[model samples]
Target: MLNKLTDAQVKSATAEGQKQRKIADGGGLTLVIRSGSKTWWYRYRFAGKQKTYSIGTYPEVSLKEARAQRDEARRLLSENKDPVMARRTKGIRQQHDAENTFKAVAEDWLQNQETELAAETIRITRRRLENWVYPKLGTLPLTEIDPPAVLKVLRRIEDQGKHETAHRIRQRISQVYRFAISEGRAQWDPAGNLSGVLKTTPTQNRAAIIKPDELAGLLRAIDGYAGQPATCAALQLSPLVFLRPGELRMATWEEIDLDNWMWVVPGRRMKGTKKAKRAGQVPDHKIPLPRQAIEILQPLKQLTGHRDLVFESIKPGRPISDNTINSALRTMGYDSSRMVSHGFRSTASTLLHEMGWQPEIIELQLAHKQRNDVAAVYNRSARIQERTKMMQQWADYLDSLKQGADVVAINRR
Candidate 1:
């Protein structure tokens, strides 16, 4: 077979009046002309069957390029492979690569996980991904991201002395890889084998002041905070209500009953598994508001009462950021090692348990997820009376503490 088509010949070729015309360039390559359009074709046989492979359009797929493509197809045939099937496989792989970028898979995971995960968990996960992972690995295809590439991103976070954050980002990356594998987007979790590769951050209990005198000092400091009044009120209310930072920050007026002295924290805001949240298996948490809580809210009501969120941020229509309370604490000379917003729960729980309150009552107030759903439902109303009493007394004890009363833990049980 000899080459029968030239670049000059191809430029002049046409099927102006005719519907279609074909010119063979030998050994399976052909030029098909349609009225004003031209295309390159490689007609070949594989496994005793004929197949026509479209190389590309005319000018784009020049004669020299078409010959190269035909030669490549011939080489595939010589290797006992079907060029058409081989080409289809390549195309499918390319499509998969395009659709399964690390960021694309992560976004899909987030959307798929929203129903299952608590709102706060979803928010934290998304924020972590957006800040740490996306900038480094987002555009890269999933399969192309090996352990080192993923580790490179984690390393940058670790280098900043954010070992815990680095670990968290690694966990997030691993989660996305797991999702990708489950969805047939990735072959293996590169992050899975790299567990020992990151610095191990020792888990420390949140910083809190359980001692009466120190806690009283913290209380007085909180009372004097001159930032936003809403924040000051939140600082005053956090320990009394026994809500997590997120639950406390996201409080809506609808959830509060000043008259009844209660705040109903919706299940979506409480911590739980994706399945529990998605199925609505996690029930709403009822908190008995102490008199002190009511006192703080009553006056603050005049300010933020018209808003949906009780602790509305300065920015309209949004709750305060998770860091707002912690930042305020920092502003007041308390660092992470000294105390945190979450430590308020720890502090109250410690002092309450030490003050002779039942562990069950404190756990219920803390909204710790119960292992047994049946027992959890049974205990929902188990100790409301005791909890209500404990709350009021807790507020009273704090009031006494703030007055510089060197008080011992009261045995109220």
Candidate 2:
């Protein structure tokens, strides 16, 4: 019988040329040393066939442990069991366990989410999971996560006085569970049962001045805002177009058509349904600029016409910071509780609705979705003539309000 190989001998062994070499220890145990790497294996004859069982790599699996494993394999073989088959079965179970872990399944779901969600949204979602969800339930199997386990994580957020965030986290967890179920990795959504379990916080609408007089005051303040010229233009044009703050700040010159009195915001720039994103097609939102809006933008073209972005910041290439408009509003004595940048949309929605305009037409102007799929398609081009007139009328109304004209509130018909 050959003597057992020593650790020193295994470490000293190196492959000559390109060929790997193996040294045999007694009792079918072998040491493979090739290219400065060492591994242990067991060679045996079982059921009239030769079989090899990988023990583990050297240093990671010490010689004593490998010998113990080899002895155990020999014991199994004496009982007519195949050690190689046993090791393969054990390895498969470990792989299955890893795949079924909550972290593993959630990662898969997040990868699928990348195609539908915006990059910023994806980043926030991943951060939330890494911070809160993963630390608690990540190592557990997907199927093992129950409502109580989920509630424990949410309660921690609630404890921090973030009631709204707790609700949002629950929704995100529910989405992950749904994804797991669809992939056949889980059977039930524990988070679905958590409805109303968390404390409810009142919804806070964005601060906006709906009254014509107050809105007029806001317009005057914006006009007199002694800020950056680009910021002043943004504040002045915000009411005319009433776009989302991001859309307004990130506006490019190519999207504008001065002669046609139109601004075509691409679907990617505007917020839309996940279905729209998944289809890789979003209808461009067309904003028909009234004469007043054109007058304001034409002069801005003289200053920023050479650049790609209409609202370039002091930094040369980036758009104005999101805080610019809100900060401008603050300087004008309107705090967040009284008014905000997003308030422009609310201001437009309320006043336009009060002006006896058709709700659908107003919604179309606001780039809001229609009630159904058919209405959404038809309304795209349905009221262009009316909308053209309405846009001009709205602008003229703002002008009247700014001039302190006795603007009578039009009742809804």
Candidate 3:
């Protein structure tokens, strides 16, 4: 048997030239001395073959501890077990244990979702989890989270009059549980059975004035309003474009190709279909600018041309608040129940359809999804020339209404 190594001898051990040197500490344990490091290794013959097992590094695992680990490995070897395999198994178990917590699994799920979700969406999701889910269920094991535990958290949100937010939290929890299931951290989604359990808020359509006379009065109010020039310009352009409030508010100067009379909203900014989001293929939406729209944008461009955003806020580089348009409408005496910023879309859609514009063209111009997949594809390529004509005509029609043209009331469908 080889003699055991001493602490002084181990401290003095060094690699010779480019080769590593090993000093045996009897049995199956050996001290490997490298150029800049020392490690403890246990070697033995098992099942008619020699096997080596790493005990640990020296200084960290002293000589006494290394020998103790060697003895444990030999014990495992005598029981027909491979110590390396056992160590690996233990490591995997520990890793699973660490990752099996609800918060740990939820974080992993959120990380995976970052690639698929928008930055703003991801931020909101993280905030929701941090504020609501994490505090209650985060520390619990994935398997330990149940419906009641989740309901308790959701009920708090419900009590706060945030029924929609409570519903969203439930859905997020369900997604987290599903992710955990896929990762082998959970068995089932506890939030899956939560459907119809929470109180449902009645759907309310955005209020809009579809009457020609009322719409004309609203238009005159916007025209006469004395506000920030940019705000006034946004109010003027809103009825012309009829874009979603968020989409219009976040419009950047780069998105507009003024010379070409087009605004190409990138796929990232557009509200895509669920299928499109899943497939990671959000198509760009194009808006053909009318002459009236161009005229409105021209003056605003001169005012805020140096910035990225067309409707910039007081804070440089930031877009106006989402409530800016609605607040402006309210300032013009249109209450929330009477006219919202989103009411522009409904007003435009109603009037265009009443004007006998093709339903497909009007819907496409409104950036709504076509139910038929092939039709959706076709609509994207088709009717651009017609849409351009239709938009200019629509702008002309609005101008006529603003100028007190004859009001023809078409029956509401």
Candidate 4:
């Protein structure tokens, strides 16, 4: 009967116009039929449970291969391993493999950090993770990330001579692992124990300060700058207020009370020192806006006052980047060592002291906190009137130096 059922007859069971029905093959093999189609499957029972293993499509898998798969499935079935159970186990393994990809964990990390970090900081962190970490470990599972795997990525960044940025990347990896743990996606953070593993070179801090005499040269460079207008304003204002680089770039018109002659730095933007808190209202810094400074604002107000920042870039809506000031400095032929925008603060503090200006006045103008708590609180006039005068004098002093005029050096007597 097996020989009489020609291979053509067996194969034709899957052909069109045939009623869907199972055609039996010798030895537990059957051509399962449904919807005018057939597929070869092996049927057997394991421990009172019936099971079927799909071998292949009808004609594509010849009778020979079907028989071969059936024999293999049966041999395993005899070994007390049901073919169906074996197939289920293999599928589970593949599912786990799919879940362990790097992109899987990175997405988890990104979502976790979104709440705690500032919007700009989050954007930067996401960019680095996507561009640097994903390409390297995107296909790897979180459980598989080891010290070596992490080090390989950091090593690549280090090789490019970006030591500072490489340090930040390592910190980011640690944060990602922490994020994973918080989400219950990972058990441990391998990045936590990896601090001293890499050979670190000692980094010398560059103190940003411009000397008083050298300020003339710096002013000439800035005045001579034929570059971005926003940059020129930043350079001109750095000495006037000496706010932090971020606060300077992110300054909005709302914070500046020109009518009151005060730059009321909000509580959020004020430095986190005890002095900031003790000086109620963060001592709304009366900038004593000079004529030149007010002139700068008139055009800038027409330009950016409608938006959040006082000095937004020409690109529209976006605040100027933190680097715009320093980049402008570079464009004017000053290297990082030569002069930084931040260094102008130090320059003013030093020169003002040399000019016999009171330390309290200079410190107040610099937005520095008075050291003695009670004294700071009690003395509301701690250079209040004097700072207004000092600011004007300083502006005039800058103008004189810029024109190469022999300005009256501060009398330290």
Q: What are the per-residue Cα lDDT tens digits for candidate 3 across 63-180?
A: 8899889888989988999898899998997777666887888788888887777767778988999998889988887777789999999999999988889999899999988887
After TM-score superposition, what is the CA distance of residue 211 in candidate 4 from its true location, in Å? 3.2
**CA lDDT of every candidate:** 0.87, 0.85, 0.85, 0.72
lDDT of 4 by residue, 300-376 (tens): 67766777877778788777787888888888777898777778788778777877898877776776766774565
User: Lowest summed lDDT over 10 consecutive residues: which window, candidate 4?
Assistant: 273-282
Q: What TM-score would every model get versus the actual structure?
A: 0.79, 0.74, 0.69, 0.68
The clash tally of candidate 2 reads 0
Residues 196-289, model 1: lDDT tens digits: 9888987778898888999889889989999888788888888777688888998899999999998888887777786876677778888888
Candidates sorted by TM-score, descending order? 1, 2, 3, 4
Between prediction 3 and prediction 4, the one with superior TM-score is 3
**Which pairs of residues collide in candidate 3?**
none
User: What total of clashing residue pairs does each candidate reach?
Assistant: 1, 0, 0, 2
On lDDT, the candidate that comes out on top is 1
296-377: candidate 2 lDDT, tens digit per residue: 8899899899999898888898899989999999999999999999999999888888788888888887877655755665
Q: TM-score: which is higher, 1 or 2?
A: 1
- Cand. 2 TM to true fold: 0.74
User: For model 3, where is the 10-residue window of minimal lDDT?
Assistant: 404-413
Q: Model 3 reaches what TM-score against the true structure?
A: 0.69
Clashing pairs in 1: 116-274
